[model samples]
Target chain A: MEPELATPFRERAGRALDDRFLQEALTVATTKFITLRREAFAELPEGDALRDQARAIKEATLQRLDYWLERLIERIESRGGHVHYATSADEARRVVLDIARRTGARMAVKSKSMATEEIHLNDALQAAGVTPVETDLGEYIIQLAHERPSHIIAPAIHKTKGQVAELFARELGRETEPDPEVLTRIARAELRQKFLDADLGISGANFAVAETGTVVLVTNEGNGRMVTSLPRVHVAVMGVEKVIPSMTDLAVFLAILAKSATGQKLSVYTSLVNGPRRGGEPEGPEELHLVLLDNGRVRQIAGPLREALNCLRCGACLNVCPVYRQIGGHAYGYTYPGPIGILLTAMLNGPAAVKDLAHASSLCGACMDACPVRIDIPKMLIELRREVDQQGIAPWPERAVFGAFAWLLQRPRLYRLSARLGRLLQRPFVRGGRIRWLPGLFGEWTRTRDLPAVARRTFHERWAALEREARR
Target chain B: MTTKAEFFDRIRAEMARTPGRAPSALAARPVRPREGLDVLRRELSERWRENLDRFQHELERVGGVLHRVAEAGEVPDVVAQIAAERGMHRVVTWPRDTLGVDVAAPLVTRGFDAAVMPGTEVAAAERARLRGLAAAADLGVTGAEVAIAETGTLVVVSGAGRPRSTSLLPACHVAVFERDVLVESLVQMGLVLEAWHEGAEPSWRGAAINFITGPSRTADIELTLTRGVHGPKEVHAVFVERGLSVARRA
Candidate 1:
């Protein structure tokens, strides 16, 4: 588990709300992303249809996932590449470390891959005597400060340029102005040398094609190219669910992925790597390794979170989520953040891990609309909440209160009798038609929010009076 | 470590648990991709003019400069003009037979340090030296294998003479192409991809393929869009109207 989870979720959210800079940055970044995504879809007439097709393709691939995976493995092995199967995150880390040891790799350069982050690979690499370098501009900044990413695509969205400048000064001992251009130039120079010198390149595959034995990576920065091309050994870590059937299916996904992520028709670079370098190629990795990580995804095949396997990791849901727009990603306290992040967290960790996070959403359904494949995140979140309640993961007092409310709701005669008794008993607490505070354990509910006072006459009583007047 | 058999067994067991699923199908692939590609090339030949116009507009929208030449020989002039404007001297390029134009000799005559990659394998030391030159060069020149008008993307397949870094590692990249390589949209590009992988790969072809839409850019820090983060800062496409003189190899 992440160390940040030690703090209660309420305190973490309270801290995020109190941070003035975080609030401003979250508002600006998410609002801009939302507008860009809207305009991008508006320009394409067949955007909605393409989204549906992408979703169907994902579902079709899942139905026969084992067959596709077998074919993918066969193709990769045919091309002189190695494939590793890791059932858990620990096993995944061990597979990569063993590769690093066999290759005698001293330093490793990485592109932006959330899979690596999900497994906490950097700490493992460090423990194994391999230095890992992050090449993406945002990833580099957060790595310098030893902080986790706050946003998926824009990893450094929570940071201001001034803070970035300070980080560089303190970490790298290089002082510069707080400008994105200058900062980017600094990172390019620093990472360029690492790319050439590093023995291994690690990355995450956006989609792996089973028909052609291809692993595809999409990035706006050219680091993906450098990582795959310059290193002597290339290692790509991908979840089993990321595989698709054919190159034709890849086209459908490529059409809508970037448009939803950053509103670009296509990112700057979409690299398709087929195993290791072939003969006569001037430059490419001599050795290629692909790690297929299950990491709790296999169980979801028959579980309630089956629809979430279709996620493209485009992060459009994050931009449009009302809860995400307010508190930002750090409050989620997991590798992934926002609406889909909650479901993915519950998938990776069980429902008990998201006992509080399942209620993070307002059930607004904006995430559903913004999702490229439309994963129905709110529906899954509701299901997770039910599971949490049924599993007894929620606190006992909260469950007891809900249980009592359910009983009262079922018995209308007892409910009305209790209401009349409470109306007479609540004379001391009633003020201005609002119950501001309760004396006992019920005060927990009204402490943060107000409850409306019961009416002088209940709805049933009012209906009876109207009927009598009509009869008269 | 989990063995392959165990992984497959786990997956199969889970898959068996869910007996019913919604009926769905993948996109229909062309039965004869190579023949389909030939037919597509013939159809695109008729609409080359309109496709070129759309390509220019989209390319420019994505921050790329497009230059038109009546003949392949004039491509060097555009490359020279771009270099002169930037005051760049070091240039790296793909081989003449693969790129369809001989820009190195002309650029060398114009007082630029031009390096052309060989069409065959070289020693490891020579390879490293060549890579150093690419990393230090100021401009890179190559040919686009497929140019898509819909998204203004250039598909470059790495091969013997066509090193991937020739278009990367440099601040400015200039690609020379003709009408024969133009496609209308990503769907057509998909068909082209299917055709390329249909049979045994050509001997000269390598393992990596890239679809570059524009110059490398990032908006990671404070959401400010900055170009030239890692790849080329400037991208220029030179179009030959009379078609390339070299015979098509693919």
Candidate 2:
């Protein structure tokens, strides 16, 4: 039986906030990336114009995704590349494992790809008796702890230098200091051999072009390039929505992804390959495969969640999310943490299974506004919250309050009276008319900050008085 | 066939639901640029530069060399020097010229396995042959249709005359560019691309359009910089002074 790969929002949040070092590390790291990305965007000189084009390009590509995917599959197949359409995480793993078995894979190295993490490909490989090695520095650290990522862009954002020093001392089989530079050195020395020794490479798509049947990978570190080239066989696991109609489509994403991710105009390496190496190339994989995972994306594409598909995986939303700011990624308890994760988990895992994820957001529009492609994440959260409400999955006290409020709302006079009484009722708990400590149920809101105070008078009463005064 | 085979066969039959049309199948689809193409071009140009700078820093981190050239006329000579210094042969590949292929006289004279025959279709077999031909060749070269100075990335659109692998499957990738072809950013370039994609058939299959920022590099091993772990370890770009006036601008 699979040990539950779940962390209830409350449980995860409790563990996260308990660690002061993790909190500090997240603060320092997120701040640096946020600052760097902002500076880079501002430095472009031609930045604003590029953002518009990149936006248009991504939107245009998305509109014609179906058309492009057909063309892409043909081109890839024609180029001797094999493609598999997987409908779920299990299917994705099955296809990749089948390929590994066919190639007799002994070892595999991987770059950082959200889709791979979402599908938990590493575990599947380990299950199949292949040693799966993470080549990304942050990913390597988490892999050592047999833990999941705590942040979108920086996986080890929750780990302080001291904690990492301890982890390395125990995991790397050596004594190490907590110094940032020293820890980075230890991590570097370990990943080199994995790249050379790995027999197969797996990566995720940044962009897939239908016109050329090419997959694009842009990265700050060149690990993505190594994972694709060094191995005899290479497999790219992508979500179906990643397909774009043309090579030109990338121009748009290229703009927003950098600004939204690291505030750069571009990443360090943007490698586009249509198929495996053909001739005298001294290196590069001999065979290439792409597994397009649908999971639940196809349903999302034709539904209200289509806006979610517009996500470029820039991590900008994660940077600005107030809820994410407080609790961080791991608190969401899934691979995709933050505003995106809340909605994604609801759809992908279904509301009943991951209901706790719904309350994880404060409905702050920071994430939506920060999004380069403009996904209305706040609206999605509200919709999911409504689902939670309907399922009666919300807290018992809140559900009862809402139930009574619903009864009162049906009668205007009662509703007005209820509002007046509610304000009076909440006064004792309020300090300076603002609730500093809630008695029960709403404790999460009051745990760290005061809840907003309600006005003494209802708007309807004020409006009625204004009408009578006008007549006089 | 076994039970699993039967299941897959049944799945295939079901998925054969809509028989796919040719790559150009979408030719009849309305050409509605959901978002303005010109607007997209302007946005991408800035993005290109931003992407280029990021690409450059990444390459540098991995101990790769990044040289920004100012002209295209000097491309061949620069490429020749790089190859010669590396003890690669005098043979070099060139990106497509709208008017004609750009194989120099000295290169044509070489008795290699096979070179991109100047005026032939860049068919798959032909591409495979060139890969075979380029293994021992001094250098593999191609001209970048679009060069983004922001990211220092060279965009090569492979079509009938150009083979996709020529730019990537070589010992050293030599990309030639004209100063004018170098766009300030990706946003500005999207204007022309929108038009280029205007009547593009969905079934129209083109070779890969590789956007290479710098030499292939990896910082995977504990963030230690390693060059040429995979792909082309060395990438040399020559900025030719003269731009091709005949090539159709997107």
Candidate 3:
């Protein structure tokens, strides 16, 4: 059964933190991944230079994203591929559905593409009578378990091998062990024939080169290639921001994306598919359709938030994110998770809708270090919190207290009085020089984490004592 | 009818409006952006290998096989054995002079279907025939314009002698490459691809550009590593002993 997702991210992250196993697992998985990724980067020559190069390339592309997207649509169509423009998820879904219906697609195999997940392609396909099969191992496991991805890259990072084995046996209707290799073998055998039988293959593009009218797919498993190549018809769903000016530009982003995502210098298969094969060529989709989704990206592109488009969905930010490392991707309540998720959710769902998402982070700079594209996430979160506060969307008591405190902070006498009053109020709860428990509104703060007692003396008192010592 | 050409024209117009071309990152390395077949081929190989070697290990670990071939001469025999052992009889490859009719003739003599094609000839009938060929054949062999030694990546550039589908539509892709095609890093590869388009039409003759490191694979169905999900299930490389592969220096 799915847990409650209607609550705000704060409550969800709080609940997740309260679950000791989740916190431990997230820490273990992300830390190991971060270590592996770091080692991989370390092996590269002047790795920092590469990161800067990746960042510069992405930023340059984002700067002219609008123009590039237009070119991409044009190029795709020129190669006998159909291009559709979707302004919203609903539109993208409707278009995909119309295509599915037209194709008479009853079953579809998909790769681990976040954009498709963002639009909830599986849910849409299932609703339309086309059963969607996830081909990425992590995504497939989560699908079988009836769960969403916990990590951006490793979707089922939250689940143990043992849990996967049990889910497979129950869902696949075959006995299987939890061994990682065995699990992989089992999944391979089941999906191999599905590739040959499927009518259409759907994929998400990492980079769509306008120069060549090509969709660049990077993957560790060959599934990404198959999903695009095997079926008679191919449907690609991509955000407009994924475009680059030319194939030459593809080389820049490709260099850093794999290293940052999973410590892979590059994925095993990086297929650059331009339109469908022509003339006497064999084994490629007869018809190719490229779906360019604007969703909320266009709105954020020109503003101060345009930097968000620079994200490559590498999940490096997710691995190092203190908040994401705790509650995982599902808690973000958006397709993207972690630092990127926090920013994207705010932009996609609006700040008022995801006010709690900003406060979910600890604002530690770990994510910044891991971000290959160098998205200044902590600054973005703080800016978002300020936006939320300015919108007056915060809880009443919190708002009221801050409003009064703002006035008091402006006056010296009132500030002193409030400080003394605050000390007296806390005096009753002081025990063994620590405040072990708190009351009422503050109770949630100390439920699992300790709240420190205020200092016994204020700065004024400490200053006076120093003055007296100086006199002596 | 909206032919692919008109569609591409609109796309070209769109690209013309983008913030122009991106500045190279290797700006400090003295921007001697190398063009020509040798330099472009070199750059493509460099970038391809860097990406391939980095990801191919996981594919191998999961079940795919990755090999490095030193020469083109070793290709036919190696390909023949792979098909024979795997029970593959029919074969397809890009129509290139280097890959040669004689190379595939051995397999044909052994009674396997053998054919070479340019990637641009893909149509409904062609795709159907290719699928039929793949179903009946054991291996689909092609040659890469550039091969990355760092990652063992095979870069297929489609043109008159090469067909994009030959590399991707096959159940297995066996590439025969020279040792000289290898590059040390992606930076060099970036230069190559850039120069490949330095002056020509953006779309050029090739419609599809692919970088394949291993067999077609996926883990999505149930988080299992399944091979041949969309493309070839196996990727084999043939490197000649006394041919052209160059390793990068520090």
Candidate 4:
């Protein structure tokens, strides 16, 4: 784990809240995304049914994952492409490194891929004496700043343009105005040379067609096209669940993916690459490799979080999530962020990894509504909470308090007695008729939020008094 | 480090351990994709004018330029006008046989440094030099294999004479297509994709199929939209009303 994660999620979230620029950026970015997504979906009359169809397709694919994967491997190999299976993140890293070593790759141009981030591939590449350059504008900015992406679609959403201008001056040694146009042009000129010089290109597959052995990459900036087309060798890192049944299924996904992510009818470039360069083709990579990454995804096929495999990584849920809107992606302390990110973190790590994270959601169900595939994130989060509790991963104080509350609930006489006692016991802590602060471990809850004071008169007592008055 | 056998074994075991959440089925694939596509094309032929109008509307909405021409020979005039407006001269294009028009010769005649890609594989050094030429060129011209109206996307396939960079590396991209290539929605494009892959792939076909919706764009900096980041800054679609005399590749 990185050192930042060691500070604990609370401190990280506090830090994010204190940063005025980040707060403003998060609000502006998320609100704009929400509006755009709503407008995009509102225009499509069939959007609702398409969401269901997309979900059904994902479920159907997972049901026969082995068949599809085997067929995909056969198709790619027949077209002279290599498919490697990795059971873990470490294994996936080694597989990529081995390929790089054999191909004599000194530098790799990368398109924005969450899969590569999930496996932490860049550091490994750097350690092996191979430079990995991020080509996506947002990703490139974050890479130079030595920061993880704050938002999935807009990785540099947390950075202000002024900050970016400063970053460029400091890192690239090129000073320019804080204009997006100028900054983008500068990046284009710098990365264009890398694309031409790099021997290897790496990308993530948005969807891989088992029918045609095609790896699909969607990007608004067209970096996906450059990384796949310009290099001598192209390697695509993909989660095992990314494969769809055929080209027909691909259309269903493409219809909603961009609208859900960035509100574009379609991203500027959607590259459907089938293996490598064919015999008579004038341009394309001579060698193509597809890394089928398991990395904790395979276990979820039949496990509790199986529905999460349906995620398209569109980042819609992130924009709509209340917790995410406030604290942003970094506070999540993981590769993914927002509502879906929590589930993904738990999926990649174990249930223990999300002990506090599981309680992060407000159970508003906005994420499910925003989700293109409707993965039921909140339901799975509740399940994870149960798992955490059962495994004794949650703090003992929390477990004991909840246990005592449950016991008291079953006994009405004791419950009523405790309520009367609690009202009197809470007098000192109660301010403005709310529990603003509490002492000891109980202060943890009150520090960030307030709790309503126990009603002065119990509901049962009020009911009895009302009945007596009615009889009189 | 896990072998393919071990991977399959693990997946198969997981599958046997539990049934899926619910009974589900995949979206129905076209049974006879080639026949379906032909039927779609015939149906579209009568209503192509409406489709083209929609394509123009959507294309412009997404920051692309649409030019309508009476014949294939008129394409170069549009290309020249665009170049003149932008003050751009150097042009790289797909070969005449592949692009279905002779734009290079006319472009050169009009004082543009136009270079047409070779129709067959070239040696490594020559290929590298051609790539450099593409990288430095101001304009790229290619033929659209499928023009989707719903999203204003021009699908271009890279093959023997058609390199992917022709549509990618240049600052501006212009694609020529006929009414027959226009489809109303992504669903129809899916059928076309299935049809293209239904039979054995053509010998000339490369490994890539690109859906170019508009000029490249990004909103990474403070969510400010910027165009032509890495790909073309301008994307122009030239529609030839009278079909090209040369046949399109399968």
Best by the lDDT measure: 4
Ranking of models by lDDT? 4, 1, 3, 2
TM-score of every candidate: 0.97, 0.73, 0.83, 0.98
On DockQ, the candidate that comes out on top is 4
Q: Which is better, 2 or 4, measured by TM-score?
A: 4
CAPRI-style class, candidate 4? high
Model 4: lDDT equals 0.93
lDDT by residue for model 1 (A302-337), tens: 888989999999899999998898888889999999
Runs with alpha carbons beyond 4 Å of true place in candidate 4:
A428-433, A457-472
lDDT tens string, model 4, B180-231?
Answer: 8899999898899999999798888999999999899999999999999999
| Ranked candidates (TM-score, high to low) | 4, 1, 3, 2
Ranking by DockQ: 4, 1, 3, 2
CAPRI-wise, candidate 2 is incorrect
RMSD of each: 1.9, 8.3, 6.0, 1.7
- The numbered model that scores best in TM-score is 4
Give the share of true interchain contacts found in each model. 0.76, 0.13, 0.33, 0.86
DockQ of each: 0.81, 0.12, 0.27, 0.86
lDDT, candidate 3, B1-250, per-residue tens: 2333443354444445444443433223214444344555555555654555643554354344655555545566777788888877678765445354345566677777787553344556665665555544556776665655445466776544455556665667787655455555455565556555455433324445566666665443323455665467677766554543322100
User: Least lDDT summed over 10 consecutive residues: which range in candidate 1 chain B?
Assistant: B241-250
The lDDT, on a scale of 0 to 1, for candidate 2 is 0.65
lDDT by residue for model 2 over A1-472, one digit each (tens)?
A: 1123454558778877887765665666566667867787676666665555555555555555655677888888977898887877888899899999999999999988889898889989999999998877778878987888867667777766677788889988868776665666565557655766688999999888786677888765557766776577999999877887764556656766867776655665676776875542334577999887777766654454656876778888887776677677766767788888777766677766456767677787878777776678988877877877898878787688878878988999888877888898897787787888886667867987887787766789899999999999
Candidate 3 chain B, poorest ten consecutive residues by summed lDDT:
B241-250
**Relative to the unseen true structure, what is the C-alpha lDDT of residue A325 in candidate 4, on a scale of 0 to 100?**
91
